[model samples]
Structure formats: C-alpha cells, structure tokens
Target chain A: MQPNKITGIGLLTAAGVGCEENYCNFTARNSGICKVTRFELPTAKVKTDFAGLIKSLPNEALPPELLQMLNSDDLAQDYVKAAVYVTAEAIKDAGAAEKISSDPRRTGLIVASSLGNFLNVSELVKDYFMKELYKITSLIHGMNSYLPSRLGSMFGVAGPCYFVSSSCTSALNAILQADTLIKSGIVDRMLVCAVDVCLETGTFHLWNKIRVLSHRNESPQTACRPYCKTRDGIVVSEAAGCFVIERADAVGARGHATIRGIGMANGASDFLKPSPELLEAAIREALALAQTPSDKIDFIAGSASGSPHCDHMESEAICRIFGARAREIPLFPYKSFLGSTFGTQALSEGAFAIKTMNDNLVPEPLNIFERDERVAANAYYKAADYSSYHINNTLFVNYGFAGNHMAVVLEKC
Target chain B: MSKPKITREELIEKIVAAIKKVSGISIAPEKYGDNLFALGLDSIKAIQVVNMLEDELDLMIDDAHLPKFTSINAIAAHFDSLNK
Candidate 1:
C-alpha cells in the first residue's frame, strides 16, 4: 500500500493555538496548566482545582451561520466549536480548503472525542432529574456522532464520516483509521480531528472519582510528572487537534511527516492496568510494518500520563522492545508539558513529533524532580537543541483506558 | 410563608436582569420593546433566562410559554397572567 503523508496540522491546546504557538511553548518548557477559574469546584471532595484550559477558544473564528446549522444549543459547546476551528485551520494549513470543497466525495472526516460533549450531556441530565426536560430544544445534540456529522456538514465533507471513541488513545486510533482508508484507496484525503473538554464541574467531579487525577492543587504547573518518583496522576485538560492526511504523491508540496506505519493492540484482560506484552506488541508491530529497526527511532513520545502504574507499564514495554538500550534512547513524555489532554493528546503529540523533525531538537520532560528507579527508559531531562541529533524518525505511543494501546511511526519526508 | 407579590415594573426589571445574565448583553430601556429573538436570544439563552427567573422568583414557567416571551413587556405580561 502507498504511504500517507500528514500534509498539515492544526492544534488548539492550553499551551497555545496553531502549530507555531504550540511549538514555541514546547521549546521554552512552558506548561499551560494552571489553577481552574473557568468553573466552580463546588465539592471539596474533588481534589484539585487545576486544569489545562484553552484561555481563549477560537470561537470568533466560527461564523454565526456555521453554528446555526446545528439548530440547537450545541453552539454553546466549546468542544464542538473547537473542532470546527481546528479543522478549518488544518485545511487552510494544507492549502486545500477549496480543493476539499470541490472534491467533497473523496475527502473523509473522522472525529475522536472521549467525553462526547459532556457539558451538554451534564446539562441535559440535570434538567431531566429536575423534571425540566421540556426546556431542551434538541435531544440529540449531545450524541457522539454530532461532532463529525456537523463538521462534515459545515466543511462540505460527506465521504466516509466516522467518530472514534477510545478514551486517551482516541486520536491515535483515528490516525490509524485514516491511514487505513488512504492505504485502501477509499478516499484521496482524510481530515482527523480529536477534541475533549474536561473543565466542566460535573466532568471534574466524575474524573475525581477515578482517583487518577493529580491532587497538586498547590503547584498546578508541576502537577503532572510522568515516570518520576513523585509522579501522582494526570492533570485533566482540554484541547483539540486536526490533521490533514493525503496520499503521499497527491500533495503538491512536501508534507510535514510521512506515516511509516501504525499498530494497535488490546490487552482484553483488564480495564485500568495494561499488559506490557500488549504494549510491546503494538510498538513492535509498528516497527515491523515500517521495516525500520528499533535503533532507527531517535526518540519516543511516550504515553506516560503521570499515573505510576501506567508509566511503569509503558516503561516495561519500552525495555522489552529496546532491551537495555531503552535507557540510552531519550523518552519524551510530551504530556508533561500540556497536561493530559486525553483524546486530543496523541494528535497534539504527533504535531510535536513533526516539530522536532523540522526543528531538529527534542524537548525535556517538565517537572521530573527525580526519575523512577525501576523505570529503565531514560526520561530525557536535558537541553535537547541538538542540530546534530540526526532526528529522522519517532515512535509515538498512546495507552488508553480499557487495555487499548496504539503506536504510530512517523518518518521525516 | 409565601413570597410577597411584585409589580409589573419590578417584574420587567427582574426579566431584564435574567436576560443580561443569560445572553451577556444588557438590554437597554429602549430595546426592551424590540424582539428578544432579534437581539440574538436563541432557544438556549431563552431557556437560561427562564431558569434564572425561576430561581429568583420561585416559580416554574413551562417551556410551552417560552415563545410568549418575545419582548420585556411581553414576558412581564406573561408572568403577571401566570401569577393571576
């Protein structure tokens, strides 16, 4: 099968909006996590009032008529509007907005969302329990398919539309699906968008019950320390990322990064803890498909979201794949810089991979006071502005809830 | 004990406050005569206004009556009829 190329990428994160802004923040080691001021954390039971919230959503980028197509209160949802803004940004970056509109049948849209417009869902549940359901104008507004369908309508993309929901690995899985469609010749191009909004009070309370969220209310920015001895848990965050993937020869210009291979594995045993064997299986599958040796990988964009068990599981998997050389290879857990954006993370980290390839430097993991002893992989903790690093390829991993593991290999074009 | 009754002017004032709270834009004394929908009060914002007024006045305004709330005076008249 012919390879697929990531021609353009658009990112909306707490770190910054757009590719340039996010890359600048990454190089400077700036964490976008901060104390929550968007909504009230009413219950004292919920631990931390901290999150990575996009300071200013690009709502102004969304025209009123575009939102009117939803015909409901979905226009009030940040996640919905964010998907459109980032998609437009990606298509514009690809320089194919007009081309996409002209060939609508050949362009597919796939959206990955973990919570699926939970703020609206929360409001609907509240009204239902309060016996105020009569106030709801549209009942289907909070469905998972709402985003991709509405986006397809707004962007004039009508081919092979789908919504993938796999928690943290959602976006990476979406990328894998996009690669499949392109390789199978189902479509000439595909737009993959992932978004999650976890800042709402109801959502915060629900995640707090999971007991895997960080409680570093005093030090919000340094809360998420993946693979470190002091690592606690993920810092919930909200973000959206969009990517335009097309056939390698189809693009007029050279693309950002070429998709060498993608791999997926499920442990099928546990819901919370992942098996190292499965994780290794995913990474090895990707390496095998790419026909690239493990040593060819310059660095790893790890899926360590600060949870001790999850980080250790990934570390074990890395050791199994690279053996003792895992300690020598740099592992950059990019989530340390942007918190755990959940669904949007894999795509955001994919953007980071492209940036590293273009800028020729890997960034240091933030807030790693001391690395865990048992975790064998070298958690990169130095200035990585190496022009001579020969950074050509990267292995990006995403470990999701319910034993879902996905790995993707990206090569410099 | 039940709350005391409110005059039509006071009702209009409360409705304006609810509109401002929901829509984030203040309805001027002159624009009170203009259609709320024309002023960008969609169904969501309208429901929010009704909810805020329900909390402030301790009454339930069924959404069946939502369309009757076109202008500030119209909302005031509707509320007065409901109380009557």
Candidate 2:
C-alpha cells in the first residue's frame, strides 16, 4: 500500500557531515575511504587501514545541546543521540517539528544497525577486566546495546521504538517499517536512524577470516573498488544516517522532502549467497510502488559491494528486470567510497540518490574501471556531467547479508 | 619420569595464540586465567576459540559446557583432564 511521502531527510556520512557536504562530495566524485587511524591493527590480513569514517557531527557544527548526548563516552548512546538530532534536523527541514512536538504521541522512531556501539562495548568489556564482571550494571550500554530504548527516551517518541538488525539491510528495513507505519496511519511521522561504530576485535577477525577485506595497505584512498575487475573486497566503515518520513499531505502542509516509493524482498537462496530472483523481485516491487515504468528510472544506484558473487547476482537481476532499458539507464555504485556500514550504507546512498534526483543529475560511481558485460549490455556506466541528464526518476538498490534485498524509487517532486 | 604433559605454561601460549586469532586480543600468557567475558570476548568469539582449540588439539568439547570453560586455563585444563 502507498504510504505518506518522505518530506525531509538529513544524513551524516563519510563523504561529508551533512546532506549538503555529502552531495558536494558525491557530485565531485570524492572518495571518503582512507587509512584507518581510530585504532591500531598489526596482524590484519588486509591492512586495518581503510574505511569511510564519519569525522564530524551535526550538533558540533550547529552547536546544540543534543550534540552533547552524542558526544558521550558510550558510542551506542552517541549513535542514538545523533539519530535524534538528525531526525530533528529533518523535521525542521520538513517544517514539521513544531507540529510533531505538539502531538508527540503521533510520532515514532525506527533505528537500525548491524554493529551498534561495538567499540563502546569493547571498552566496557575491557573495563570489566579491571573490575568485576558481575559488578557491571545491568544497564551497561555498548554498541547495539539497547539502542532502541535509548532513542525513544531521548526523542520522547512514544510509538514503536524498535531496532532492525538484518546485517547490511538493517537501515533499509527500518525505512520499510517506517513507511508501513505511516501508511497504516499508525503514526503521523516516523524517524529512522541507522548507526554503527568500529569494533576492534571480533569485527576485525570476522572479516579477516572471510578474506573479503581490501588489502591495499599502501593506497587506502583507492582501496574500495566497487564494480572494478581488480576489486578485492569491501572495506568496513562506520557512520550514522537518519531521515524523517511523513505523509505527503503532512509534508505538503509543512513543505518537506517527498518520498515516492520503497520496496523490499528477501532472497530464498542460502543466507550467504545472492539470488537473482529475489533481486529482480525487489526491483519490480519498487517500480510497482513508484508506479513508474523501468524506462523512466533515469539511473540505478547499485549495492555493488565488489564481491564477485554479489556483483554477478546483482548484474543478472538488473538485466532480467530492465532488459534493454537497463543498458540505457546509467548505473552508479557509491559503496566503494562509503564501505558497507552494515545496512546504513543503503540508507545513506539512497539519500544521496534522492538528492541527486533533486539536482536533476545522477551521481557517478567511484573506482569502477570496467562494467560487467551483462550489466553493460543492459546498463550504462561512465563519468558523465550530471547536468546534461534529466534524472527525474532514480532507483536505489541495496543487498544485505543473509540474502536481503531492498529497492527504493525516487522522483523529482 | 615422563615430561609433565603439556605444562600450564605451554598450554597458555597455545591458548593465547588461538584467542588472539579468534578474538583479536593480544594477551600475555600470565593472563590466561583471566575471565574472557570481562576482557570483551563475546559469545561469537568464544565459539571461534572453541573451534580453534578443537581443530588444534582434536578435542570435542560440547557447546553446553562453554560457559564453565571461560578462562584459557579452564579450557586447557578441561581438555587436559579429559585425556588424563
């Protein structure tokens, strides 16, 4: 069913601190991945060197009390605080905050993350080494350590404060949930946040074991090479993204960003394997929701993580769904610079694509030297001046671990 | 007399390496008896350690007994005692 359109979206990512900066970087085709400096890693298979780390915060830039909560020692707490702050920004951007504040009961929050405050938990766990494990309070908060409750408490959002953790699909699923709530008239407005922080050990070793991490120790800047034949694997990164979604009428009354449509589906394949059928289904669902034909979708923002298996499945899916038009539709893969921050990557990239649509141009994919022939035969990939194109319609696609696929359609409003 | 089979010191070195590989923590051999949970090793990492040990020493420790075998010393001793 069609829900209310998203009226406003605010984002903080590695490309920049907010929507404006992220757009600027995207338009310029700037890469955010760089040598890791947050922590030390000596024995990593790939250098613990590259990531799309968010270096700034909105509260700090805007100077607000909300920023203080985010700056707390607890990283998970900081993520919630950041989510609330960004939601407020989106509301203000939508011009619906005063109305939302008036009827707090009508508002809700859905935050998603794969690795919440893992760094904070690691520190606390380290602290327990010095103290007694049993002595640690039951309320000890760390990375995903009860982020949903914390977000609810901070924002005074009373309805449906929940966290969705579907690995990389977490954020997109959160958005899907928010859309459902708004369409069902369960809430007038919903704030969706996706946040994650770097954990030193478990996270690091997991990737090392899989050997899907980039080992370009010398050139961290170019480490993430999505869609490139030489692409080794994805670099892990961290950031928090949030947006405020409300009914089109509500947003029209306040003049916020408009949401055209959102679609989600799961692959029936093995949890770790990608499935073309599911990917096509997700794209079709999004197109159906947008009520726009495939030809109208000017560009496709891909969830290409540079894995051979994932790229193959996604390429096949695009070819199947769009047919000849797929070749004409410009394809963009932004994850090479952003690194896959679990599920939040999709939310942030989707937001970027929406902004690009607003600008009437499609953002270029970074570090892609060659396009898959299947996709190339069905899609276009190259650096072109966005100004020359009319990106009235765009599709944002993301895939998550365990075969979760999501697609969202955006149109110039 | 037969050499004291796999002395505590020898076991500590093996445990430390395995833990480092699985949990990504670098701890001294002297710290083997320390509670791993308190040291930030989660359930996932604990499982990794058990798997590593099983592969290294050919032991088939049951998953049900993981919690009781929290420390490196505990895991090593549990394996050692089983063979004894």
Candidate 3:
C-alpha cells in the first residue's frame, strides 16, 4: 500500500525555538552548541561544554492551565508539555488544528524517546538513596512514565498513543509508525514527536564509562569534530522535535509540505557496534521508496557523530550505496551544530533538511577542515555552497546504539 | 445536624474533577462506568488518573487495579471503600 505523506513539519531545538529561527541559523551555518549553562556538571569531563540547549521557553508560552500542570514538579509531564507545544505548532503550521481539534478521534500521536525521563529518574533515585526520602510522588512517576499518553490526552487525540524507544533511532521509528498508521486507515493525521533531556550525575558516569564523551575542557566548540581527523569524541545534548503528518490526499487538499518517502532498517549487529550492511540497506530502501535515484539526491545529512568507528562505518555505507556518485553528493553533518541527542537528531535534521529544501540551500558542515578523503574521492562531497545551487532532494541518515539504522528522503514541493 | 456521611452523588462530582484534572477528559457522571478504553483512555492515561487519586484523596491504588477503574463511578466507589 502507498504511504501517508508528511504535510507539515515543526521543530524546537538548541539552534532556535521555532522553524524560522532554525532555518536562519542553518542558512548562516551557525552552531547552537556552546557552554552548558542550564545544569551543573563536573569541570573536567565538561571540557567541551557545548550543547544545543533550548534556552527560551517563556513562562507564558503554553496555555496557563497546561503550564500550571507542568510546573507541579512533574518532570515527565514537562516532556509531554514540550511535545504538545511543538506538536500543536506543527499542526497549526499544517493548518489542521481546527480539523483535528473538532474531531480528535481522526488524529493520532506517536512520541519517541531514547531515555524516557532519565534525568528525572536519576534525581529521584539519588534523593531516595541519599536523603532516605521517598518524597518522589506518584504524579511525577506517572508523568515521566506516560509521556506519550499525557501528550495524547492534552491534544484530545484518542488514536494510537505510544512511545517508541530504540536508543537513537526513536524519531525515525516514530515517523515510520505514523506513516504506517495513516496508511492502514487507522487515522487520517498523526503527530510525531521525539524528545530527550540531558543526564544528571548517574548519566554522566554512564557516558564516562562508554568513553565516547570528550574530556577536553579548554574548547567545547572544537570538541565534537564529526569527520575531522583530529576529532576526539561526541557530546550529549538535549532537544525535542515534532512534525504533523497527513495523507497525501489530505495534505494536497490543504496544500501543505509533502513527505516524499521514508525507510528504516536494523543493523542486527551488536548493540554498541556499527554495521555497514544495515546502513547501506536502509539508504537503498529509502531511496527506492522515495522513487529517487541515488544520482538525484543533491545532499546528504550525515549522522557522523565524531565517533571514529561510527564515522568510518557510515562513510563506508554511503560509498557502498551510491558507489562512484557518493563522492559528489555534498554532505552536511548536523550533529556538529546540535550535539547528538540520540532520538532527536534524526527528526531535528529531517526538519532542517525540509527547511533547506524550502530555502533552496544546504548548510555546510562546520569545523571539518579536511573531508574524509575516501568519501570525498568516491562521493560528491563538499562543504555546501547554498548560493550556487538549489537543493531539490536530500537524504537524512540516523543510527542508533542497538544497530537500528534509518534513512529518509525528502523532496521539494 | 449534618448528614451522616457523603452520598454517591457528591463522590461522583469529586471523582469527575479528579479525572478531568488528571486525564484531561470531560465526561458526564452517568457515563463514568463506560469502558475507558472504548472511550479512548489508554494505559498511560489510566496511570495518570490513578496518580491523581493518590494525590487528591491520599489513596494508593495498585497498577493492577487500573483495568478495574474504567469509569468515574468505579474509581469513586473504590476510593470510598479505601477511605473506609
């Protein structure tokens, strides 16, 4: 069966609060990663303090009632509120708020998370163990645990409301699920949201154990170098992204952005290791579903997260998929600007690609002085020049910890 | 000269407010016993209502009891029994 198309997309990230701001930042090739100012962390491990943190959620941003409910010490509920806020904005952008609001049964919601309320969990556990206080209320637990449902309730959407947790591939998985639900005639419209917040003390230790985190305290901006030979490690960031998707017929009637195609695959490799085969399959499948030939793909939003092995594997996958043509395709590493926030990266970059297609430009990969020579030799890879070209089609790739790989293709409407 | 105890009618009102507060649902008291799942109350929303009950009424309901608290009347009765 044919899939449902995404008619509208909205995003809130460390770059800026809304699509317009993010688009401008992208066009200007600006990076939102800077010093981590919201929370306190150890001075040593925070060497590269850069993170794409959303800094401007005004108190009056959400409905008064919703804001009150969120401020009630319910961190999980705050995530729901964050998802709802962005989802509502996307729906509004799609011009479907009235239609869905009047008949919510016709709408569905899918939220994805790599670590659901991990920050809140860490704090609660710490308080329990350290202070010997069981003051963590059930409300907090329920909100943290039921973010998807809370978001559904807020929007009055009675359709499928569940969380997709696949480490980093959660966003793409959520989008794929929304597409399937719409195709099955289960719902006419769906809201896809991806969110993850930064870790607290325990999370810091967990990353320290993984040894993928940068410990360079001097310069944070220079810390996360995705394709650079001098790259050390990746920095974990926090963000949330949402999109409003509808059937092609529905979107056509309303004249909204069109979702050309989406594809997903599993690595079937070890949870921590990379898989070239799965990545290639995912890209090939996404291109096939999009009905886009590899040559037509103008740019690629690389998921090169500065992990040396992952970067090499991803580069190899691209070479395998596009063959000789891969070297000519310009590449944009979004995570360089927005620190890798597992599930949010794919959707966030997807949103960025849509904006790039809309603006007729592609943002350059920042901080990479030299291209991956092998990739550059085989693929049409370059720091993109937005002024000289108009990007019609683009591919966005995302890889998760459990060998889950997803690639999505979007075209200009 | 007050009434000996609270009536079912009074209990239903409180239950309705709590449900609305927790699950963001608006329903008439008479429709409380209706299948919440059929009414679009999924598992996550069920947990939200249970948490609200614990907060508002100081009652602890097991996660297992969620399937049984499908309606306003049912949750109210359960809370009433617990208060006893």
Q: Best-fitting candidate, measured by lDDT?
A: 1
Lowest summed lDDT across 10 adjacent residues in model 2 chain A is found at A134-143
Model 1 C-alpha lDDT per residue in residues B1-84, reported as the tens digit of each score = 767788888888999988887778788898988998788776456767766776687775643455578888888888887665
Off by over 4 Å in 3: A44-50, A68-71, A75-78, A135-145, A253-257, A377-388, B1-84
TM-score of 2: 0.77
Comparing 1 with 3 on TM-score, the higher-scoring candidate is 1
Single out the weakest 10-residue window by summed lDDT for candidate 3 chain B: B58-67
Highest TM-score model number: 1
Docking class of 1: incorrect
Error of 2 at A231 (Å): 1.0
- Candidate 2: tens digits of C-alpha lDDT, residues A253-323: 44323456777787543455567787888889998987888878887888888777677778778878888
- Each candidate's fnat, listed in order, reads 0.00, 0.00, 0.00
TM-score, chain B, model 1, is 0.87
Could you give candidate 1's per-residue lDDT for residues A1-413 as a string of tens digits? Answer: 66899987989888887778888887776768888888888655566688889865644566565655654365567777788778888988888788788889889999998777777777878888886675544367677787898899888997899899888889988988998898888889999999987568877866765556787889988888998888777888889999999998888558888899988888645466666888899999999999889989887889888877778889889988998779877788888888888887778877887787766676656789986887888785464444367678888988877778889898988
Candidate 3 residue lDDT tens string, A76-100: 3445555756776687688877778
Candidate that would win on DockQ = 2
Query: What TM-score, computed on C-alpha atoms, does each candidate reach?
Result: 0.79, 0.77, 0.76
